[model samples]
Target: MRKLLQPILAVALGLALGLAVTWIAGESPWHVLKILEKGAFGSGYDFGMTLFYTTPLIFTGLSVAVAFHAGLFNIGAEGQLTVGALAAAVVGAVWSGLSAPLAPVVAVLAALLAGTIWGAIPGWLRARRGSHEVINTIMLNFIAAGLTSYVALYLLKNPDSQNPETRPIGPGYLIHQFGIFGGAPVSAALPLAILAAALVWVLLWRTSLGFEIRAVGQSEPAARAAGIDAGRIRIIAMCLAGGLAGLVGVGEVLGNAGKFKVGFSPEFGFIGIAVALLGRNQPAGILAAALLFGALHKGTADLDFETEHVTRELSLILQALVILSVSADGLWSWMKERRRPVIPETAGGVTC
Candidate 1:
């Protein structure tokens, strides 16, 4: 109950903060709240859009959560995702004539391989050179951005198009969009994301590798003393983390965009950190948190037009507040501890 209630309270606090901000800006908080609700769920189409936005968040959230279990911070999911998308696009474009089923399979494999390699570099550096994963991952993100941009602009750019994007993938590689909900761009990726979440849950709870990862996270010295290869486990965990994040590419390139766009991601990778934190790094919790964020993203789209003062930035503000509230739990607990009554010590130095 505490676990459930904590997240609920955090979300409530975030919403309240957003409402207060709205009121201060001279907007009717009630009207904005109603607009958010209507935009998110007024129609089936709106709901589908929410789900569509959620698919990639699920992948990125799981990626971060997996790394957290291994006591690693993978801030480079954005880089891994970018390279994975490029790989998928390259494979799909080059092998456009392949059989329908085989094309997507090959493209997905390319994405996984690319992401795994990108993620492994940081893991290897951490294990072999004792370099910090945080610094390495952050550096890799800039490299990936530049590399992908160069490729999109020169090698992959469609001849007749003005946008700095790759050529469209083969139709055979494209996941069919579900026309349910009035042709909202929801695709097969939603079910795939759910399956990925279930698979991650099983992997973490039912596997020896998972045990080793968790053990290393809890106490690396103890794991080393017990003859577990903590470094190897960390590297493996990082690879798996990257592979999961790479699936975001599959959703975007093959599932929705059909090409690798230069600026397709709106910091989905960074936002995933909040999702993982809010979910407490649990798969089930991550799914729920991702859905909430997805709804926020979809619902806030119309704020610019619907209200005079409110804008879509309110979503970011709300997300920031939630993250702050959840992350400050330790501070709150420490404050409570400071306020607790102290028992007097006896002459024997024992406290009553």
Candidate 2:
């Protein structure tokens, strides 16, 4: 019960704090909250948009969660996704003549390969040179941005258009949207994301490699003593994490946008960290958390028109507060501990 209640309490506290901020901004918190609720679920279209935003969050959330399971922090999901999207765009554009069914498959494979290689670099450095993954991943993000930018600008740029994006991918490469909400962008990727989550759950709990990864996360020394190659596990975990994140590109580029845009991501990679943390790194929890954040993203779109002082920035504030509240569990426990009275030990078996 405590485990279940913790997240609920944290969410409540975060919303309470967000309401306080809203009051300070000279707005009615209740009104703003109502607007948020209505906008996120007012119609089928609204719900579909929420799911559309959620597809990528699931991938990125799982990417971070998988690395956390291996005691590794992969902050380079942005880079991996960017490069993977570029690869998918290139494959789709240059090989437009491929058969309908084969094009998307090949594009997806290209994305996975690109992301795997990008992720493996930092993993290799960490395993072989004792380099910190956090630093390496951060640096890799910048490199990926520059490299992808150059390719998009110089090589993949559609000669007929001014946008810094590749040409339209072949129709064969596109994933069909369900059109459940009258032409919303929700595509087959939503189901794919859920399937990936299920696969990840099975992989981490039902496989030997998963056991080794968790064992390494618990203690490298113990894992080593037990004949597990901790370094190799970390590297493998990182690669898997990268591949998961790379799927974000498959959804956005191949499924929705049909091309790689220069600034397609709205910091989905970084937002994933909060998702993983709020979800407690559990697959089911990640799904719930992703949906919540997705709702926030979808609802906040109309803030400018709904209120005079409030804007979409309220979403960021709410997200930050939630992260802070969730992370403060330890500090709250520490404070309680400090306030507890120490029991006196009596000498000679005498009690006070």
Candidate 3:
């Protein structure tokens, strides 16, 4: 229960700080809250859009959480998702005469494979070459960006459109959107994301590989001493993380856009870091955190029209504050330890 309360308290602190900022900016915090509430849940369309935004965050959050469990910070989920989405788009656009289930399944597999390969590159570097995963992942992001742009612009450019997007996918590649969303593009991807989260929980808690991954994360040297191949675990964990991030493409390309738009992602991969941190790298917690951030993203859209002093950028500030507040938990613990009274030890080595 104490562990559960930690994240909740941090979130509350962050929200209080954000509202105070709003007050300082000459805006009524109450008005801001009301506007955000209305913008996010005012209509079925609004709520569905929030879920739409949430779907990708779930994938990316799981991606980061998986890598975190393996003692790796996978900063390249953005790159992995970019490459994976392109792979899905290319497969969907070029494949012909395929049936419904087969077409979508093939495209999704392509995404997962591409993401796995992209993630594996850095994982291999860290495991074999003694290179840092963070640096390798960061470099991969730039490479993925440039590579995807070249493909979208030259290789598979939509001839009829001037936008930097691929050709439209086949009809069979398009997933079914829920009518309950009031014509919003909320699709079967939402349920798939939920299923993925559940599967991740099962994988991390109910498997030997998961045990090895967690053991490696706690201490690589100790895992090595226990005869576990730490390098292999790291690589496998990263591969899984990348594949999860790649699933974001399923919702973005097949479910919503039916094409690969260069900037379709509003940094969902990056926002996932915050989600993972707030959730304490737990699957169930991540789901809740993703929804909260998703609502914030959708709700802030109305700030431009509804509020005079506050804008959508306020959401960024709020997100940053939330991350800071959560991070401060470590510092708070350290401070408490420092202030704790020390007991003197006797000559016999017993505490006095």
Candidate 4:
């Protein structure tokens, strides 16, 4: 429990710190709050958008969390997500004549496979050649950036449309709608995201495979001594992480756009690291963090609409602050000790 509390406390402290920074910058905290409220929860439309925005974040956050559990940093999630999206887009366009069920199934599978391959590159480099995943994944990001753009701009460009996107996907591959919520972009992916989270939790906590991964993550040498294949485990963990990130493409294409945009992702994979940190890498915490980010994404528009005084860029500043504070707990601990508030018992992990 102690593992979880410290991070939560750190975020709270960071939020206060962000507010202070905003104040010093001549912006009122109230203005910040107003912007958040306006963007996130103003109406059913806003709420729907919040859920919509959360789709990619949920999968991406789990991607990082899973890799972290294996003691590896899958910074290549951005590339994985992009490649997966590209794969899905291609499949979506090619299989347009098939039955809806088969078309979406193919597209989603292609996305997963592409993501797995993308993730495996870094994993393979790290395990076999002893290359740092951080370096390889960062490099992969550029490769994906170049490749995805090249294809989108040339090979996949829509023939008749002015937009830089591929041909429209089949209706079958599109995310199902509540229909009740008109044009909200809320799709069947919500339940899928939740299911993915549950599966991840069960895989990490209940399954023997999860135990193997965690054991390696806790300590590679100890895991090797216990007869576990550390390198294999790392590779598997990264593949699964890639698959999870690829699901983000499913959520975006099948659920939101129903087609692929060349440059759709605005660093959802990168932001996921912050979400995982805020949640302390726990499933419940990850969900909460995703929702918080979703709300922030949703509310920023409202915040800007209600009060044009502060730009949405300020929200980015706050996000960075929260991440810094959560990652650095000593500052929060000292402050908590100073305030003398009883720290609530939490699942605070020992590694911190």
Candidate 5:
């Protein structure tokens, strides 16, 4: 219960702080709250848009969470997703003649494979060469961005448009959007994202590999002592994390854009770190955190038009505050634990 209660309280605190900032900025807190609520859920279209924003976050959240379980901080999710999205776009456009069903499947596989390879490079470096994953992942993000830009601008530039984007994929590559969202681009990708979350939960909780990963995360020395190949587990966990992050392309390319755009991502990968942290790196918690972020993103879109003082940038402030709140909570817990008196054990049984 503390696990759940803590995050909820942290969120509330963050929201309260954010709203107070708005009040100080000469906006009524209540008015801002109403606008946020309305913008996020006032209509089916709005809600669908929120889900659309959410789909990729789930993928990235799971990606980070998976790496976290293996004691890895996957800062390279942006690069992984970028490479994966480009790979999917390349396959979808190059194989335009491929029939439906098979087209998306193959493209998605390309995405996963691309991301896995990208993620593996850092994992292998960390495990074999003692290179830090954070620095490697950050470097890879730049490489991925440059590589994708070169490919899109030079190799597969759309002849029809001057934008730095790939050519449109074949119709077969497109996924169907749900009509229930009032024509919002909420697609089959939403269900796929939810399914991915469920599968992640099962993998983390119901499998031996999960235990090994968690064990390695808790203490590499202990895991090695227990005869677990900690290095191998790290590589496998990173590979899985990359594949999950790669699924973001499934929604962006096949579901919405039908092509790859150079700057399509609004830093979903970076925001995912906060999602994983807020969710406590658990799958179910990640889902809830992702949805909250998605709603915040969608809700803030209207602030510029509706409020005199508040702007969409408020969303960034809100996100930062929430992350700070969670971090402070964790720090407080750690301090409390450290200050707690430990009962000593003696050879006989207990020691005073």
Candidate 6:
């Protein structure tokens, strides 16, 4: 019960704060609410957009969750995702003469490899030089951004095109759309994300390898006593986590854009940490939380289009507010107790 109520409470608090801000700025509170509502679920198309956005979040959130389970904080998901997308774009663009059916399969594999390599670098540093992954990943993000930008702008740039995006992948690389459901733009990658989440959950909880991961995370000395390779496990865990981030790349490029753009992700990897936190690091919870955020992202634009006074970025503010409320859970707990009637202590003649 509490688990469910917490999300409700967070959302309520966030809405209240957002309405207050809008009202103070001389905007209609009800109008903003309507905008948000209509934008997120106005039609089947909107819901499809919600799911399209969510697929990547689930993948990236799971990536962070996996790292957290291993007692490592991976702050470089942006970098991993960037490299993965770049790798996929290159493969899809250059690999020719292959059957159209085999294109997506080969492209996704290329992305996974690039992301794993990027993750392995930090893992190696931590395993060998006792460096912290947090710092290493942060630095790597800058490098990845610069390198990706260079490729998108110069090396991969379509000479005839005006944008800083790469050339479009061949027609065979496109994911088919299901137009019967109100023209939803959902791609094939959504199912892959669901499968990835389920497999990751199984790998973490139901497998012998999962035990080793938990053992290494719980205590290095104890893991050693249990004959687990602590250092190797850490590296493997990082690569595994990075692979999930890479999947986000697959969904975005192969499923959505069908080509690599200079800026593909709108910080999906970054927002995933919040999703992981709200989900309490569980895969099932993460799915729901990711969908909530995904809806917010898709719906916020509608809010702006509906209400000229408001901006779409207000959704980010609401998300931040929710995170704040969740962080202050202790206050909510105390208030709940305070509002309840006090019960008399039970002992012999306790009422008297």
Measured by lDDT, the strongest candidate is: 5
TM-score of each: 0.94, 0.94, 0.94, 0.91, 0.93, 0.90
Q: Candidates' lDDT values, in order?
A: 0.88, 0.87, 0.90, 0.82, 0.92, 0.82
Over the stretch 204-286, how does candidate 5's per-residue lDDT look in tens digits? 88999999999999999999999999999999999999988988999999999999999899889988988999999998889
Displacement of residue 22 (Cα, Å) in model 1 is 1.6
Clashing residue pairs found in predicted model 1: none
CA RMSD per model (angstroms): 3.5, 4.0, 4.0, 4.9, 5.0, 5.0
Model 2 regions more than 4 Å off: 335-352
Candidate 1 residues 219-284, lDDT tens each? 999999999999999999899888888888888898888899997887777778889989999999
Which residue pairs collide in model 3, if any? none
In model 1, which regions exceed 4 Å deviation?
A: 338-352
Candidate 2 clashing pairs?
none
lDDT of 2 by residue, 1-352 (tens): 8777788888888889997898999999999998888888888889888888888889889999999999999899888889889999999999988866899889998998888888888888998889999999999999999998898899889887798888888889998888677677888788889999999999999999999988998899999999998889989999998888888888898778888999798777887887888889899999999999889888888788999899988888888888888888675675665587754663334322
**TM-score winner, 1 or 6:** 1
Tell me model 5's lDDT, rounded to 2 decimals: 0.92
lDDT order, best first, reads 5, 3, 1, 2, 4, 6
Which pairs clash in model 6? none
For lDDT, candidate 3 versus 5, the one ahead is 5
State the TM-score for model 5. Answer: 0.93
lDDT-superior candidate, 3 or 6: 3
Error of 4 at 49 (Å): 0.7
